[model samples]
Target: MRVLTGVMLCVLLGALDQTVVIPAVPAIAADLNGFGHLSWIVTAYLLTSVSCTPIYGKLSDIYGRRALLLPAIVLFVAASGLCGMAQDLGQLIVFRALQGMGGGGLMAMAQASIADVIAPRERGRYQAYLSGMWGIASVAGPVLGGLLVDHLSWRWIFWINLPLGIAALILSNRALRNLTVHRREVRIDYPGAVLMAGCVTASLLVMSWGGSSYPWASVQILGLSAVALGLLVALVAQERRSIEPLLPPRLFGHSVFTSAVSIAFLASAAMLGATFLLPLYFQLAHGVDAATSGTLLVPFLLASVAGAYASGQAARRFGRLKYVVLTGLAVATTGFALLTLLAASAGPVAIAALMVLMGAGLGTCMPSSLVIGQNAAERRDIGTATGALLLLRAMGGAFGSALAGAVLALSFGAALTQAGHAAGIDPGLLRTGFRAGFLACTVVSAAGLLVALLMRDLPLRSGN
Candidate 1:
């Protein structure tokens, strides 16, 4: 119980910052006079966090979860302080990237640590706690950030992490004391880690800048894409030749690990795409204010938490994980299909109901996939396997958001002037764009369903 509580705090610490900084973005930009580079404040954290997750996982496998987790918490807290005291936008961006180094470990290590203490068969119910923390952070972050920025300062958003990080650090240290550390004295794969980080950074930069900062077909985007590809090839070669690869290629040979991560990737893409667009749909199509639209999102967020808890409980009780995942994806796909049919005049109740359906459906799959991945991997590779699953999941979300943004731009382009200002876009056009986005999510969800169908349902391990 202490371990679970400790990790949930860690999860909250990591997840909260992701959403909290969003509301502060405008404030931070204004104060620092960096509207041009505002996106980097968020993009920098995401890039580092996602790239470092696998590294944390692999290292924890060698050094143990507690060893990595303690340092990560300290780093996160220290970086948060630095972020609060940033003298310029560049400083904040650098600190945010540093914070992400720790944030990535917080998440990956939490998942791996849970696997260390709990049996795979029973891990789902506990995972529900972490999922709930994410839902809470997602819902509360913007609101808390808004209040802090309005009354106090945008820096408070970062400063607020201090207390939370301290609590998590103290608790994790005590709770994880008993966790077995099977340290392996092997040389760290610096070359492979560097190549992997470079590849992910380049690829993510392309994703972040493609439509917003540079045209997709521009030299900058193409150059980054080529760099990412070359680095990926080098990474593959390095991993294959290395004695102890950072990400062992053998993990993919396990049908369970491959299928689990693939399904997670697709499901995350669909879920995140819809999530990114739903508020806009409410604001544009239903003509609600930002606050009201946020209010409307509450049902979806709560339903997601409920769904995760229910599925976890069911998985623990019934012991068949695949069916739970399949059913959830089917429901989510159906919700997305229905969402595409929503008219511009769709009522708040109707939209909220659909959100609930989709939220619940996708939520069911999130934690179950993690358990499935860990269950399939060799015991020693649990951290690595978890890291891989999360890495793909993050990539999927980034892709989904990008896809949704591109779809929305199609309508915005037709409605707006050459200056790229939104001069009161027609509601009909807005609905068209939103519907197209929902349709895209439907396809993504259907893909997840298909992957789930093909996945082999490995029996959950009775012991870790």
Candidate 2:
């Protein structure tokens, strides 16, 4: 209980940061007079956090989880404080990047710490705890941020993390004291780490800037794409030859690890891509406000939490995960397919219900995939494996959201050109674009289902 509490606090810190800052973006821009660079406030955090995850995991495996986690918490808290005190957008963006370095460690170490104590068979239940934390963060973050911004100030969003982070640091320190540490003396692969970070940053930049900031075929985007690809090739080569790779190349040899990571990438892409679109769908198609759309998303989020809990219990009872994940991917695929055919006349309640089904299906597969990856890895490689799965998941989500956005842009561009004004744009045209996005989601989910089907079910370990 103590350990779970500690880790959940760590998870909360990371999750809340992602959601809370969104509401404060407008206030942040106005206060700093930097509307043009506002996206960087979030993008900076994302780029660093996602890029550093595997490095943190690898280090935690070499050092102790406790050793890395304490510093991560401290750094996150310190960065949060700096974020609150920033006077300009540049300062805020830099602090946010610093915060991401720690935030990534918080997430990676939390799950890796859980693996240190819990067997793969029992890990599912704990994953539910993590899922619940995320659900709470998702629901409460914007609301809390709004309240803080409206009542006090935008800076409060960052200041708010101080008390919570300190508490988490305290609890985690006490709980993790007894965690066994096996310090490895392997040479650190500095080049590989640098190469991996460069690759991820370049890739994410392409996703973030393409179509939105620049044309997909623009010189800038092409340059970024080439850099990303080149870095990736160099990274693979470095990993293959290095004495101690940042991400061990050998982990990919395990069928379970390979399959789980691939499924994670595809499933996460579909899930997060749809999540990104749904709120816009509500506002544009249903003529609802942002707050109401958030409210409407509650059922979907809650159902996801419930699905994760149910799936965890099922795994505990059945001592199996493959069929459970298969069922989930299948359900999500169906939900996305149906969404492609949905009409605006279907009403908010119907949309919410469909979201529920999709969320639940996606949530159900999440814990099982993590368990599968961990179970397939050698004991020492658990952290490495966990890191790899999460890395792919994040990358997949970026790709999926980008893909959906591209589809929407293509479909909506013609309508916008014809309408000649934002107010004159038809809801039916928006629906068409959204449907195209949903169709893309359906294809991604179906591909995930196919991967799940092809994956071999390894027996869950009864002991660590």
Candidate 3:
């Protein structure tokens, strides 16, 4: 329990950081007088976090979770302090990137530590706890950010992490004292790590810049895509020959691992894509305010927690997860398909119910996928495997949001054109656009359902 509590504190810090700063963005920009580069405050963190995830995982496998986790906690705390004290947006962005470097390891280490202490058969319940933490953060973060910005200062958003982080650091130090360290003589795969980081960084930049800051076919986007592809190819080749590969090529050979990764990727894409569209649907179609829309999302967030807990119990009882995840995807796909039929006249209660279904499906599939992926991986590669899954999920979220945004933009434009107005708000036109966006979500969910069906049921390992 002590260890779990310590790790959860770390998880909370990381999860809260991702969202708790969002509401404070405008305030931060105004104070720093850097409104033009406001988005970089968030984008920098995400880019670094994604790029560093796999590197941390591989290093932890070499040095041990406790060794790496301690430094990560310290870095995160220090970065938070710097972020809180930043005199300008440039300093804040740099500090935020540093924070991401630490945040990336928090989840990977927490999950890996749980695997180290618990048998695979029993890990589901604990994984559910992590999912619940994320859900709570998702809901509480924006609220806390808003409260801090309104009642206090935007700096408090970053300052709030200090006490929690210090406590977590002390607890983790004591709790992880007995962890076995795996000392090996193999050389670190520095080349592969650098190449992999480059590949991920370039890919993320493309995703962030495409259709927003630059056209998809512009030289900037195209050049980044080409560099990303080249780096990926080089990384793969280097991994094949390296004595200590960052991400072993052998992991991909296992159908279960590959399938589980795909499920996580697709499930995240579908969930985020749907989430991106839902608020617009409420605000534009039904004329709801931002605060009320946020309030209405509570059902979706809470339902995810419920679904995660229930799925964990089910996994423990049945000693299987494939069917559980499959059932989740089925429900999610159905929920999204139903959402395509939503109209401007739909009641709040009806929308809330659909959100519940979608959230539950996502919650069920997420933890189950982690359980299955860990089960499928070799004992020595647990950290790398977990990290890779998370990295893919992060990328999937970016893709999903960008794709959904594109679809909404095009569909809204077409609908507005048909309505004979390009600038005025039209409920009917907004509804039409929302239908198209929901249909895109339905398609993404359906794709995940198909991927879930391909996952093979692997028996959970009884011992670590």
Residue pairs clashing in model 3 are none
| Most lDDT-accurate candidate | 1
* Two-way lDDT contest, 1 vs 2, winner: 1
lDDT of 1: 0.90
lDDT of each: 0.90, 0.89, 0.86
**Cα miss at 440, model 1 (Å)?**
0.7
RMSD of 3: 2.1
In model 2, the runs with Cα more than 4 Å from the true position are 414-422
TM-scores of the candidates in the order shown: 0.98, 0.98, 0.96
Model 3 Cα displacement at 19 (Å)?
0.9
Mind giving the per-residue lDDT tens digits that candidate 2 earns over 1-464? 78899999999999999999888999999999999988899889999999989988888889988898999999999999999999999999999999999999899889888999998889899999998999999899999999999999999999999999999999999999998888979899899989999999999999999888888999999999999999999999999999989888789988888999988899889878987888878777777889998888888788888878988898888888889899998888888888889755676667777888899999887777888888889888878788878888889989988998888779886566677844577767787888999999999999989988999978788999
Q: What C-alpha lDDT does candidate 3 achieve relative to the native structure?
A: 0.86
Give the Cα error of residue 50 in candidate 3, in Å. Answer: 1.1
